[model samples]
Target chain A: MTAFIGEFNCKLDEKGRLSIPSKLRAQFPEAVGNTLVVNRGFEKCLVLYTKEDWLDETAKLNAVDDFMSPDIRRFKRIFTNGANLVQIDGAQRILVPKKLLEYAELTAEVILVANGNKIELWDQAIYESELNVDAAEMSQLAQLFHQQRNQG
Target chain B: MTAFIGEFNCKLDEKGRLSIPSKLRAQFPEAVGNTLVVNRGFEKCLVLYTKEDWLDETAKLNAVDDFMSPDIRRFKRIFTNGANLVQIDGAQRILVPKKLLEYAELTAEVILVANGNKIELWDQAIYESELNVDAAEMSQLAQLFHQQRNQG
Candidate 1:
C-alpha cells in the first residue's frame, strides 16, 4: 500500500489546469487509474483523493442512517457538496473545478501537501501564512502528543 | 443508523468512568453493540467513534502504501498512538483510559459534542475557553462558509 507523502510545488494555469509533478503523479496507485476526486477540505483548502480512497470514505457515510438525524444529513451534503471527479490528461494535468478553485482561493501559485491518504491543495501564500508554526512549536506539539501516548 | 447529536454534559467519576446520558446513548445504533473506539482528535480533545465507524476509518488507513512515504508512517503512528477500544457497561458508563484522560486534560467535568459521525470529548473549561465564540462571531463564520459554498 503506497501512500502520498512530501510536499510539492505546482502551478495552476489560468485555464484551471494543474500539472501534477511526475514524482507525485507516480505515487498514484496504478489501480486508481486516472481519476481523482476533488472536494473541499475541513480547512480552507481543497482535498484531492484517489477515486479508490474517495469511494471508501463515501461508503461509510452511505451506511449511516440519514433519516435518523438532520446533522448526519447536513454532514453528508456538505462533505460531498462541491466534490468533482477529474481525469488526468495526456500532459498529466488535471483541471480543478472552478468552484473548488474558488473555495480554496487557489490562484496561479499553489502547493500540494501530502497528508497521508489525501493531498491538500492550497494557495501557497495562504498555507505559508496560516500554518507557519516555528519548529519549536511543532516540536512542542509533537512532544506533548508523544508524552500523552507514552503516559496512556 | 441513528447517530448521536446535540451536546451532552457529563461527569467523569473518580474512577475515570464517564456515564453516558440516556439521550445520547439512545442515539447509538443497536447494531453497534456496546463497543466504542476512543482516539486523539486533531485538536486537543478526544474523539469517540462507534465500533462500526472506527473499522470503516481504519480500513481506509490500512489500504495506504506505508512503504512509499514516511509521512504516512508518522501519521498512522500518531493517529492510533493512544487509541483504546472500550465498552459501555450495564450502567451506560465507559472507562476512559488514563493516557487519554491526561491527553485531553479531562478532570471531573467534560462535554461531549456530537460531530456527525463522531463525538468529541473536551474538558469543559478548555472547550469553553477555546471554542467560546460569540453568537455574532459564529454567524460571521457560518456566513463565510456559506458564501464560499454558494459561490463555488
Candidate 2:
C-alpha cells in the first residue's frame, strides 16, 4: 500500500469541521466506510485513525501493564481519554469534538502530517516550529535509530 | 484507503521469503513503487511498512528528545534496532532478514495480520494464542478505551 505521505493544510470551519485532505483521501480504501477515531496526541497535535487502526492501537494499550506503575496508568488514562469516534460525511469532512479541539489546541489554521500509520493534526505555527528543529538533531535521530536496529 | 483487514497464512520458503497474499496486495496502491520497510514489532510480531511509512515513522523518533531520559532512549533503541528495508520482487515477495526473522520467531507457517498502517507477520500458532485472550479482557479493553474518551 502507498504509505500515507506529505503534509496537508486544512481550515477548521466555525463549527469545527474540516475536510479530509485529498492527500489522505487518496490513501483510504473505499470499502472501509467513513468512520474515524480522533484523539489527543503528543505536544499540541491531535491524531486521526481509521476505526480499524483505532482498535489495533487499543490492543497495544491493552498489552501494556498499566497497573504496574502509576506513571504507566496515568499515561494510558490520558491517551485513552482523548479517543473518540467520528464520522466523515458525504463531503469527507469531520467535525472535531470541542474537548478534543481544545486538548490539541487546534484553531482555524491547521497542519496535518502523515505519520505512516496515523495522521497528526497540528496548529499551524506549532507545526512550523516543530519542523524548525536543527538539522543536526534530525541527523542524530537517524543515527540513533540505526544503532538500535544494528544491535538486533 | 481501506484499513487493511484480513488474515492469511503463508508458507515460508527455505530462504525465508514470503509472498504478499492477494488479500493484502489488493490494499496497496499500484503506483507507489515497491520498496517497503520491515521491522520488529511488539509481542513477537514483525511489522511491515511501505518505505514512505518508514520515513513517516522516523519523524516520530525525531520528536523524542533522545537525551531526555534513559527510558525513552532505551525504548527507542529497541524499537529502532529491528528495522530494515526489503524490496518486493516482481513476484510480490519479500525476504525477511535473518535478524528480524529471529526476532519474531518465524518458522514454516506464518500469519499475516493487517493492522491499519502496518501488516504484522506472526508465527501461525503464536497468532492464535494472541487472539485467545478471554472475552472479558477484550470487553474490558473496549470499556477502558471508551471510559477514557467519554470523560473528554
Candidate 3:
C-alpha cells in the first residue's frame, strides 16, 4: 500500500470549499462520480473517505451494543451521529458544512491540509500555532517506530 | 472539514501494490502526484501519509530530545529511520516497500484500510481476525469525539 505523506497550506474559499490538490485529485477517479463521506477526525482536523470505506467503518460502529451501557450510547451519539455524507462537486471541492467547519474551528480563510491515510483539514492559524516541532519529539517518535518494527 | 470514519478491507498486489479504492480516491489526492510516507501505525498495521503531513508529524518526532533517555532513541530510530517514502503511480497505486510489508506482516494478498485523519493499512487476515467493534469500544470512541468537539 502507498503511504500518503506531506503537509500543504492552502486557502478555504468563502463558501468553505477547499480545492483538492491536483496531485491528490488524481488519486480518486472513482470518488469523482460518487458521494463522499466527511466527518470529524481524531486529531483536531477533518477526515474524508469513500462511501464503501465509510460503510465498513459505520458497520462496526453500528455493531456496538449501545443497550449495554451509557458509554455505548455516547459513542453512537458522538461518532455515528456526527458523521456527514457529502458529494464532491465537479470542481473537486467538498463543501465544508458550517457545523463541521466550526467543529474544526475553521474560519474560512486559510487551512492546512496534512497528508495521512486520510487528509486532515486544519485552520491555518491554529495549525501554525499548534505546530511545535522540536528535536526532542522527533527522537521519541523514531524510537516508537523502531520498537514497533522490532515487535512486529 | 470532513472525517473519514471507518475501516475497510483491501488487497496488496504481488508487487506490494495496493489499489486505492476508486470511491476513496478523493480522500487521498496526494497519492496521485506526490510521494507518500509509510510508517508503522499504532495498531497492527502500516500507516500511510502524504509527504507534507509526514513532514509535519516527523517534525514533531524530530523534536524528541535525543539525550533524554534510551527509550527516546528507540522511538527516533523507529519513526525516523523506519519510515519509507513511496511514490504514487499514475494509476494512483502505491507500492508498499518490502520491509514495510513484512513489518506489517502483510502477505501480499488482502489488506484493510482504516480511514481516520490518517489511513491505517492492515493485513486483511489479521484485520479480520482482530477487528471487533463492540459497543464498549464504540461508545468510548464516540465519547472521545464528543469531548474533543466540546473542547474545540
Better structure of 1 and 3 per lDDT: 1
* Candidate 3 error regions (>4 Å): A1-6, A29-32, A108-117, A138-152, B1-152
Model 2: CA > 4 A from native? A140-143, A146-152, B1-152
User: DockQ (Cα-based) per candidate?
Assistant: 0.02, 0.02, 0.11
Residue B55 error, candidate 1, Å = 1.0
lDDT of 3 by residue, A42-105 (tens): 5466777666666877777788686899988886778766578786788877787889888888
| Cα lDDT, model 2, residue A134 | 51
Predicted chain B of candidate 2, TM-score versus the true chain B: 0.86
Q: What are the chain A TM-scores of the candidates, in order?
A: 0.87, 0.86, 0.75
Better of 1 and 3 by DockQ: 3
* Among all candidates shown, the one with the greatest TM-score: 2
TM-score, ranked from best to worst: 2, 1, 3
What would the per-residue lDDT of candidate 3 be over residues B1-152, giving only the tens digit for each residue? 22344555567778888877766666665443656677766556788766666667666654544435545534443344335567768886888767667768987655546455467787777787776688899899999999989974
Candidate 2: tens digits of C-alpha lDDT, residues A55-86: 88788777989669998889778778889989
Give the range of the ten consecutive residues with the poorest summed lDDT in model 3 chain B: B73-82
Clash count in backbone of candidate 3: 47
